[model samples]
Target: MSGSEALDQGPLRVLSFGCRLNTSESVAMRDLARRGGHAEALLVNTCAVTAEAERQARKAIRRAARDNPGTPILVTGCAAQLRPAEWAALPGVSRVIGNADKLTPEAWNAAAPPAPVSDVMAARQAAAHLVTEFAGRARAFLQVQQGCDHRCTFCVIPFGRGPSRSVPLGAVVEQARAAVAAGYREVVLTGVDIASFGPDLPGRPSLGQAVRRLLALVPELPRLRLSSLDPAAIDEELWRLLAEEPRLMPHLHLSLQHGDDLMLKRMKRRHSRAGALAAAARARTLRPGIALGADLIAGFPTETEAHFAAMLDFVTEAGLHFLHVFPYSERPGTPAARMPQLPVPLRRERAARLRAAGTAAAEHFYQTRLEQARQGQKETVLMEAPDRGHTEHFAPLRLVRGEARHGAVLQARVLGADARGLLAEVA
Candidate 1:
């Protein structure tokens, strides 16, 4: 049969991009597509976080079409939702499904779906799509919430994701249990605004409460981690988890967009420079050796050198070991886009400088850990590969072959360091 004919009766092959939340949703799309009898179609689950992400998606669509020949291609996710007509006009695309409609089973069927997705801003809740396994990985992502309530001027996700909504607490626990039963050693609770979890649910349980309940109910879950955290939203329950929960991994990736007060205000962020430092210090105090990571944007509208300098200083002051840096990209319709803009080249240059700082901080943190290793400290490592695993502090370690089996949680003694990761021997 022709590839298109086969697609009419077969399962879907999903190409996922972007955040862990997108990864989680892709699994559901595949399952729904299979049940809907379009198992043979190819779905491009796109990301629109940056212009580059969108560019890659468009490139991949053409590549999928070229490689698959007669196979039908379908597009969805944030990118498609944000620019439905743009995706629909692409050469190989047979249908362009919106973020909200993609989860419904009927939308996955071979029949052409409805045009231009309903206004995503009108969306009240994120659809609940349960996934049993993570397809190919040892770790799985469980989505507890969807969308964002915050409207940071530089961000486009809130519009793409809609107003904040959360999955019920009981539903979250059930999903965690399923993941454990499926043999996943680690499960990450992911969302566009994970910190805002429970506000829409009854009693408005905080993210901390959700984590506490999940860990308590799923005792067998080996490791639980969070995808991203907003600095202003760190609650007491989360602090308690850091202090007492051994199963909770000791890594936090913070959403601290800018370090300068004026830039922060312009970005519409809730936390201040001092507040971020305090939160990081508190986390470390509660869990000694915890590694802190952060997301930083290098250039924004009206950003001066002094503003950039404050951000550069904030990295070291806050002692951030890992950083995700982004050069501000102007998305259409955002307030920041209309502000006095920075030179595109300058934005990229600043981003590069921030990344360099991040590298130095990472190297310094690694050296400090190695010092502890020399002093005979050991870390609990979760083996992702036969020769490598990540420590509880989220540092990668290379193991001596045959020293520890894959998937084994071993007390690995760090012997020394290399450019990529720490070299270790099973203790």
Candidate 2:
């Protein structure tokens, strides 16, 4: 699980869980709650990606009630959206807000009644919320799309997020502009299925088109990044952007659930094993030395030992530098949940193996980076903290000398390498 955090310095505290999109929404919700006079409330933005995620949210809710006494706890997010009554019955939860109304002004009004959960599947249009601040974050997560249209057999997110929707290009530019104006050196475009962006809008512009326009319109923005992308859905324009746009960071994280062809088909993933490999190859050809990452599920229903072995080898074959490995967690109401199940211990064991492979891959990639650094190659580092930041390829870097300020972008030369990241000095 991605770490959860309390946003803002106001009386209204927000605990955001799960994805960057939730974090972005939490920032907006904090402002809305303050403006609507809900200062004494604690908002819990929950995630339903895994059963463990939901368990953590419930644990947090109980802890918040025990520690804070009478502070009203408001629960919302994919978890709460999927199971409103379950969350509402928890101690100290005064309201259970759904995803559809969580950002609306009325939902946070102190005088407003508890709003009924709207049908997320009926959400036709996604409106852009101009979020200029990210509290403690150096990079801003600018949401350019929302919801999902695909129904992967093992996933339940589409039900919670609804149909695919795109925030208009003009509004996206405005938000990017606002984020850049607010001192963010990097802006990550986030959404549920961002590659599916723009088909719902006028002229049906692709994600590539929107990104190209965003870069063109905001020349002041130093670096732009993207959240997880669908390998099957990447368009020609986006491939060209990777080849040509220097401002676009050279890191691509693909939503590749599994590497085995049969496993991918069972997971209802659109891209096959060969197709995924081709995508990785294309990315490398377009952007030399590009770092590739993927979301891989370790164990799925009916996954044989051979299938697991193939997936483990695929990581090395694809040259994946980063991996988000999830042990198969059965979300009820999903197709995979009904299939023959694997033992929990076995699933976890496979996850560990996948992670081990990923670590080895990362170490190899870092060694190459270190070699480049030793050769006096320079890298642009975005300082997320005083002593640490990340390179353009999204590798963690540490400043061994030369003072660095948070949110400052500087060119640096690598001095050394370690297990965690690179050691560098401002150049």
Candidate 3:
């Protein structure tokens, strides 16, 4: 083929998988590819948050190889971090770069070791790990930090991601500008620990400082969102900025792994249920009615019935918008993994109860919003369901008829709570 023919081939499609933290690294990878004069490489960013996610990621790899034959594949992110060896053995994978290489300055060099492909079928079936980045979404995330220092016994992330490290602030600001110019309405500031955004950096300008710098870079961008944050990471300045910034999403996702103090201590997590409660209260005081969500591990080792009740009470009183609940899964390496295991039956019971609590909390928060909507509170819902787009808040406002456009902020009048969100008809 001629040089012109190769040049017109296409941009490299790179995909990353996992939470927002991985998204930042993947964005860095895309930048590296673009600057090196190979802007045509279409980077396919993929995700693998669960076993299903892993399976789907592998599926994407195979699909990519088939659709674009001879493409040099780069497998990366948490899946890479956790199972680099497994990916290295897969067919169609030109490079099996893991957590280490994904973040390296040269993410898409395509000049690395090739896989052996000894057992092509085995490699193909192996799962894709969690990737931090998301591609083709309206928003992009800048992962400022990686690795969770928290030793939550139910979590395998600390093991998979290793020690926490912050990306240089200057680089982050530059990345944010590029993303904004690319037409992403929003950029999610993400990381394994976003609150620890600049702790490893000299002077640690703080997560708030980093975000303020980002806004300063692309003030025109309509919105920016911060991913999960530990209550311990919150400070007065952070909430104050959130209260003042219109571009920043009024969404604070606090990680409340468990509501019981003793269970939290046993998990080696930093915050107590009381501490989490205080943090939520602080956030509400600053941004009243701001959407606050959280995560909860339903059952930890040594969690008694009383402990579960305490967790339920805490969540109920705290008024969380929603929660992502999980039955504690003991990974191969972790302190809780060695403790006297809870029977599968009990784990199921505890998880179900916590789920109920989560639903009640979500409903209560939703109802509060509904009441406000009834009283003529203006809700700028991203009209999606009845043929349009939706909100980053992720609340479903049942399919309603109107001129609902993707990205169009609708002035909705709340009818009542329907199957969707605060059931509102477009006004």
Which candidate achieves the best lDDT against the true structure?
2
lDDT score, candidate 1, position 285 = 95
lDDT (C-alpha) at residue 178 in model 2: 88
Q: How much is 203 displaced in model 3, in angstroms?
A: 2.8
Q: What TM-score against the true fold does each predicted structure earn? A: 0.93, 0.98, 0.77
Off by over 4 Å in 2: 8-10, 130-132
Q: Rank order by TM-score, top first?
A: 2, 1, 3
Candidate 2 lDDT, tens digit per residue, 1-427?
Answer: 5468777576678888888788889888888888888878888999888888788889989999999999999889998889888999999999888888887899888788888888888888888875556665788888888999898989989988888999999999998898888888899999999999998999999999999999999999999999999999999999999999999999999999899999999999999999999999999999999999999998799999999999988998888999999999999899999999899999999999999988888878888988997787898999888888999999989989986889899998888887787888899
Preferred candidate (lDDT higher): 1 or 2: 2
| Candidate 1, position 313, lDDT | 96
Would you list the C-alpha lDDT of every candidate in the order shown? 0.82, 0.89, 0.64
Q: Estimate, for each residue in 262-299, the C-alpha lDDT of model 1 and write its tens digit.
A: 99999999999999999999999999988999999988
Q: Tell me the tens digit of each residue's lDDT in model 3 across 18-71.
A: 555555456566666666444444453434334445666777777767887776
Candidate 2, residue 235: Cα displacement in angstroms equals 0.2
